[model samples]
Target: MKNIIGAKLKAYRAKNGVSQFDLALKSKGKLSTSTTSTAETVTNYDPRLSTFIEMYRYVDTPFDELLTEMGYGESYQSTWYKRHKGNS
Candidate 1:
């Protein structure tokens, strides 16, 4: 699902009119010292959950609205169950 995450990240970035480098810098600031170095190493367009959360904080869109825009609907529970039935 990296592609999906990447698309979502790109959409959010565009909505905020920020570049990938700027987003990366903002994400890096949200990390703790131990994870700071690793966080800063993210050079690709893919974004982590924490990074997305931080972005949401700066944007006018709500979390659910963003998720819906990303094609993630309210059926998350059912979707998760289907993807990991054996593990559960």
Candidate 2:
């Protein structure tokens, strides 16, 4: 799971042209360079929700979109989900 998130995070960084150090500084220590580096790595980088929020704000990307990229968002948009939502 961490690896999955890491790959997505890496893509965002590449798109934004921000380095690990830059992310750390921009986030004002909510994210560290080490954490950024790990999150961009190919393994072992499950970040906290706060990190997701921070990145979302920084890059103007939806937090749910990140989850979707990790294949965790479809259920919410699936037929079952639509039925469940209607019931609720």
The 0-to-1 C-alpha lDDT of every candidate, in the order given, reads 0.53, 0.68
* TM-score of candidate 2 relative to the true fold: 0.62
**Residue-level error in angstroms, candidate 2, position 10:** 2.6
- Model 1: per-residue lDDT, tens digit, 50-84? 65566455556655566655667666537765577
Q: Name the weakest run of 10 consecutive residues (lDDT summed) in model 1.
A: 31-40
What root-mean-square deviation over C-alphas does model 1 reach?
8.9
What would the per-residue lDDT of candidate 2 be over residues 1-88, giving only the tens digit for each residue? 5356556556767888988788788788888888777666646556688876665665544655666766677665878765675474
Judge candidate 1 against the unseen true structure and give its global Cα lDDT, from 0 to 1.
0.53
Which candidate ranks first by lDDT, i.e. highest? Answer: 2
* Model 1 ranges with Cα > 4 A deviation: 1-28, 31-44, 77-88
Give the clashing residue pairs of candidate 1, or none: none
